[model samples]
Target chain A: MRSTCLLLCASSSASGGGMEALRVFAAAVIVVGFGLLATTAVFSRLQRNRFVAALIAGGLPAVATGWAIGPGGLNVVDDSTVLLLRPLLVACLGWVGVIVGMQLRASLLATVPPLLWRWALTDSVLSAAIAGTGAAAVLSWWFLPGSFGIETALVPTTLVACAAMGWSPETRSMRVVLTPSTQQMAMLIQGASGIAAAVAVAVLGVAAQLIRLQPDGTPVLDLRTAVVDLALTAATAAALGVAARHLLGLARRKRGALLVVFLGTVAAAAGIAVDLGFSPLLLPLLCGVMIANFGRERLASFELFIMRAEHVVALLLGLLAGVLLTPRIGLPGTGLVVAILAARILVKPVLARRTLGPVTHGDANRSPLRFAPLRQSQLSYVLAVSVVLAYDAPLTRTVLTAIVFAGAASDAVPLILGFRRHREVAQERRSVAGAEA
Target chain B: MGERTDMRLLVLIARSEAAFDPLVTGLLDVGISGATVVESRGLAAVLRQDLPIFAGLAAFLPQTTGSRVVISLCGADRLEALRAYVAELPPGDRPLAIALPVDSFFGLEPTS
Candidate 1:
């Protein structure tokens, strides 16, 4: 491990610094490994109980654990340590992107109820619009005119909007739900969340390419460059996907061998994407989409393997987010959070009533899925962290902090509402039974 | 030894993967050394596969079925013993077993 670390440092001689820096890097890797292991052990123990398992599935607890040990709290995961783990974090992000992308099996999706797609599209557009406009206003007012260009603000705002477009897909923790009554709604939420996550990641990846920061942190808009980069990345991702699929076949359906193929593919794609100023989330996502849509039967077990690791990857990213978060939710940050919350709380339900109502046969008050939209999508964290990585700015950290807070808060909304719904449901059942008696 | 009419094809559908071990042990103890175990899934597993990754943990839950089907050819005495063994197992761990009469069979080595 030391030799490999040294080699990695040696290969990048320009920024390798010296012995002390290498020591810090090694320490960071050890710290992060131990942190993840300890966190996993605790989480695994807690998840044995179905109820606790559901709660942990939402991902805030992992984030909180990360935050607790992070520099802001305990100084265990300091900034320098996080900087050293950049490549690993990028790979983790790619892992998540692949999971999201793998859900895009066209054949499978075609069989889904049309209501899911409609809900996903509606939520994506409205959430993005609400988040983008509100964030733009806050950001515009927050930044001085001469400090930065509109493109700088535009990129983060767009990414934030993209982050706001989905809800948590976790249904196991929702114990209050009567499965028979809410099964369709739960499935709809899960399916739409996947679609919304795909849209958000893709849009965030594309929007990220539109702006490039110079050595001095000046944001430059280069449309031709963005388009060319995007096209190249997409082509490269497709090639990688084909190669990965072929390699997976050669793996002889062994889980260990399949895992190696996945890791190598994600690492290569993420490295290339990061090197080319593209969102590392896009390439592996495209690769996953390719893998899912083609040669699917052969790779079914592989898909299962990836899905099995999804929560672990998600929690890892959440932990990284916690480590990377600066908790500097300034005035603009506060406003942005409020904007996102208002949109999720107010706009989302009304939109659901207007669009999903007809098909669902119930509006917000009548629908079992009423609170489903309130929980922020876990993919939002992935996007926010990607932005933090792309731009190491105070503003980006604030965005991440706001997202974390919003996600946690949004998660609570569903629990409270679901409990009330559960009680009301029991009461109604008893009343009906009494009348029948 | 009894005639071929005494043979029975026993099919045990273990409700979970964990149930196969004791079942196989019991089958072996009942003098049935040959059996085929095939991995199987319940309808819930199929539906769970359609869920997004967030709820994919359903695949790992203890309650979720990872069923296996065990098929074997045995004599009436061994089949009864296997059935008795299965009946002795805890209700939750016991697999559903069915015995079909076998008219003819081959590939058996007669003991010297």
Candidate 2:
């Protein structure tokens, strides 16, 4: 590991050495081994205790490690190398999108009751609206200044809001949800809500940004530009979906071909979105869904195959996002971070109870549905990182810092509650059973 | 050779999905590596796990994702060691484990 790091650090001896590539390849092999160990831990201990499980899935350590190596910290990985890794980061998001998209198996989703779907939709809409409004307000205040026009603040506003809207179900696998909802109804609620939350994030990613000035100081971005971005993303993804359909056979049979197809298609979809000034995260996600549903039967194997790769990419994405978190955040940046995290934390449960009040009763009324929105996962992480990478401003720093903190805390809360709730129940039972006797 | 000898099948029914991987890994570390894990939910799983908690909600459902069964066919000589190792694991967290003799076996041997 030391030798590999040294080789990686000594890159560009007058620039462009095959040895540098070789060292990176070597480093990847080591990283993959570590990723495998981490993935094994994730799966092995997944159902252990929800709190410990959360600790296992937590990105706090990865972020800390990233900080240690980051330019702001140890400087082991500097800005230029981080720049070189941008394509890989985008590819990581693409893979995350694919993992999410493949979960939209129509046959599976069809089984979820309409009542739960209504609840899920309501939960997502409420959370997004509340979080978005709060984010927009924050950016309008001390966050965005002369860099963005007051009239055009919607661009950064919606982007910040989009970061807070995603919630993860943290399924043990696609085969089962990790939540204690063993019943069909409960499982359906969990699944539908998770899917609904992801869709909400996707929609937020591509929503209107109104008018903004170009870096050249020429004014650009209008309703027309938004329309064009929407058109280009949809058209590009649709075309790629068709292209992927033909390549699916070769990809399924040949391992090398599989990697090329995914990397190529995702790269193209993401690249096209960037060129068109659209959210690059949405297109590959669409493409992934399209591919998975396009030939539904053969997709399970492909999904599982990509899952092995997904583990590695997930760690890297978390690490890179962590690396971007700097030590410096002025008072304004701190305020913006606090505004987003606090609003999300404050809004989720209150809104959940209000929306779910009509649908449930008894213990179910006291349900977990409201609690989940507080937690954020890869969907939230990828979106926040995408915005930071795209906008490149002080506001982005605030969003990233806040998200890393919020995501870890939010994910821990509900999971820890799962175990704590059980322990409390057992304690209550111990006394109550004797009292009943 | 070891291939010619009859073996015992190590059968473990773990209460939790969390225990499955560790059991497999433990066996593998002791050189009893080849194992098959299957998703199974028996009456005990429904009653003891699902019914008591999920209760009325799961009672009507056709099947729930419950209990996991892990099986590995091992050489007869290794059964005692496997049993000893499993015995060492904490009781509550451990699975319901047993070993059954394989009278006759067929098909291709697992390629390690």
Candidate 3:
């Protein structure tokens, strides 16, 4: 009896060791796969777009392949892989945010009063209404009906609301969709979207507490505490920005000082945010905005650095998203998927047109303006928000993953069509000018 | 030397043949007529598998886009004309012009 018991313990220990080894091996494979994808992506400059498309196309099938591979697909990977990938994704996002923030700095200051006020009001109201309604509906139907009570629904809804509230305009894509005439219209739409996103996040936090039936029904961190934390984060970023501006001023004659300062500040802001448990995304953006508004000469210098960093980050994030996406887990029910598509494709664009009718007309007749296509960057923001949502509600992770994949697919067609239209318009203009000449 | 003078070489490097017509026509309007256009591949134009090797070979290879390069060598006397001409041609933020001293040349005779 004693010998039998000892034998059993020895066998169990051996099995544990084998399992650990398998996990490490699986992690190694994923790292290798990611590295290859990143390398391929970076090297293929013109082909980068194609490569990304291919990767996304392969994602669903790859998930299916994982499922076919059995227990190794579901259980072989460790938590550490997720941990490693998260920072990389955050860093990439931080870099993009910095670039965006830099671009918006000038506009933020130059924006007219009525426009600014309208934007503030519109964003706050729309973001709150959309996020609140969506959360309520989702919670009532999905969570409340299941084992999850209001408490569980509260956290998820808050997460969704926060995501809904934080919209970053896709400036890069806007250049594609509308001609110069529609730029202001585009900018207005983008501005409103961003404000809405921010307000949504804040309201969601408060609403979550209320729904959770927690004492005070407010964020555990009071308004004062949250404000202080936000201020500290902003202050740190500002100080870095100022330091960068001064260093840049002193080294105005230096060839690469601008690059150094730009990179150093971006990295520092992102790192600090990660360490402090604050939003890494917002800090870089704020820093960018501050620098853009204050440092005119340095702006050009900062742009180059930001672009290089953005490319690196975008590639890394794309690869990670590809690796982590499991189509099986978070596949939204057909109804939900259709609803999301309808909201994004039909409802959102129509609402945007109604809100921005005059501006769109103005854009059509005028010079290549800043903003016309209100829908610009909306897709990317929606995708990013979906990912953020996934982080909070692990169950929806797969669905969000699918959404990103599908969004990418749908986006490609519109982009191509828009590009072709622009080309035709440009050609027509040139011919007319030639005829006159 | 015929004259001790400074001259500018204006080069138009384009990715497509379609771009060549506008660029050349614009240059012509600025009194620039003759230019040496070459075809070469750009760094970004290289294939993915060939990038590492291309980066290594970049030092040895001439800076070419495989697209088209138009080079106009103007005399020192024509500097102002060339500058005005290039300026009017297209708005490329980067400098596409290089000033080099003409030591000697043995090509065509000067126009009357």
Candidate 4:
């Protein structure tokens, strides 16, 4: 027994040495990512250009890591690492959704339904078809190859199609950066995105059902369950809205109490979601919408608190995405990247121009709704897809990381340029108006 | 107070151009003139500083820099005319306008 123990210790020590080194490396990456993010935050605050800050803080580290380790850099952290972080990620997402939900409520009231709704429908259809088709083509060529026959491709394609509805929080981010004046446009875009996402989610659920077959060829995610789930999600959202209204009334009387209530309600909802096997994102979004649209005036004023929390969560999510990138998943084929970029930049803009042409012209004098074009949305979609893809192919974790990195990069450049342009135009207009007067 | 006459005053507070054009025009249409305007900043506005130089010194200094305050004093008989004018002004939360009674005024012209 003593001899056996000695042998076990020797072998364990050898493995420990290698594991310890990897752990240190992972820790270093996390620290560096956080440091960069902190720097970006500080710089952003000083400069008052949050878009620039987001790019620097969230984008730079992800790109550097992706370049160094290739697509699979996140693999170094191991599956166990992701497993541990998953709950935290879910919690963070929940909090973010809540905050967004609150904001959405406020924005919805200000929206002119017919025009905004029309834009949303158009964007959703175009984005989904383009993104889904692109993802399907890329994944088929690279991962599936000859593995999928036409029948099998349907499920994966559906998954990819639904995934195509992904959009970045860029519009929301822009709202934060350009406040008061641009609020109307921001609210419209947010409303459009929310509607589009809902539609896409519905498509995804349908697709999931279509593809879900047993070993002998039966169905999973039965239609009844899907319907029930949908109903429940809607009901939950309504309940959340009612609750927020009551909470807001309470909050008005005792200012700080809302924070505690907000946290508690979210925690309970998250728990319920986990138990019920619901789309965790939907309920919180509903809650946010309800609060923003229907809650008391005082609750609307407490939006700053929710926004602050969203920023922190978004930062953390970006950092985690960075750490998750591994060489295998990170190394997206150049063709695929180009295709994704093209779909977002070229195809999306064209579609947007075509669909929103009438609205654009009519509202030329009024504020233009600034949807964070396909490029930004594509990055967010890619990140979400990468994470979803990771469930099946562990190596895809790197791709998710790369998505975060690329998104940070792509989003930063355009946002900074856009912001500068917007600022200049504003200044020019102010001067012109001043001169006119 | 002697006759208990109705009156109106057009009060305006703005940093930019004078927003009292409509009010003034409306008041003129109603056959009222000779208003007394006083400019002062609110306590909150006066306490605000461009740069937070010294937390301690902030209490000593006024809250804001370059704030314009205008109070229009008119005859008590023009209250109806003033209410209509104030209602037409652009609405906002801060830099508000309020109408209060004047018990008596000396050497004021009666509306023609």
Can you tell me the DockQ of model 4?
0.03
Which candidate would rank higher by lDDT, 3 or 4?
A: 4
- With candidate 4 superimposed using the best TM-score fit, by how many Å does residue A30's alpha carbon deviate from the native? 5.7
RMSD of each: 8.5, 11.3, 12.6, 13.4
lDDT: the better of candidates 1 and 2: 1
Off by over 4 Å in 3: A1-78, A85-87, A106-128, A144-155, A158-224, A250-260, A296-298, A329-339, A355-393, A396-399, A402-437, B1-112
CA error at residue A310 for candidate 4, angstroms: 1.7
Supply the TM-score for candidate 4.
0.57
Model 4, position A234, has a per-residue lDDT of: 68
The CAPRI classification for model 2 reads as: incorrect
The residue-by-residue lDDT of candidate 2 on A1-437, one tens digit each, is: 00011111223443537754554454355445546765564544443554434453445666776677666676555444555555666667666665555555566566656665665566556556766676666666666544455334554556556555545544221212323432333444345445654575477556532333364433355777767767766677778877986797655435577778878887777766655556666777677667756764544334444655544665676777776786576665555566556756776666556655665554544444446545665555566666656555555656677767767767666765555655665687889998999
Give the per-residue lDDT digits (tens) of candidate 3, residues B1-63: 244245554565654444456666666665556677787555433331121110111111222
Candidate numbers, best DockQ first, in rank order: 1, 3, 2, 4
lDDT at B37 for candidate 4? 46
Cα-based lDDT at residue A358, candidate 2: 64
Model 4, residue A27: distance off in Å is 6.4
Per-residue lDDT tens digits for candidate 4, residues B12-41, read: 554322343455565577666655544454
Docking class of 1: incorrect
Q: For candidate 1, what is the lDDT? A: 0.70
Error of 3 at B49 (Å): 27
Name the better of 2 and 4 by DockQ. 2
lDDT of 2: 0.57
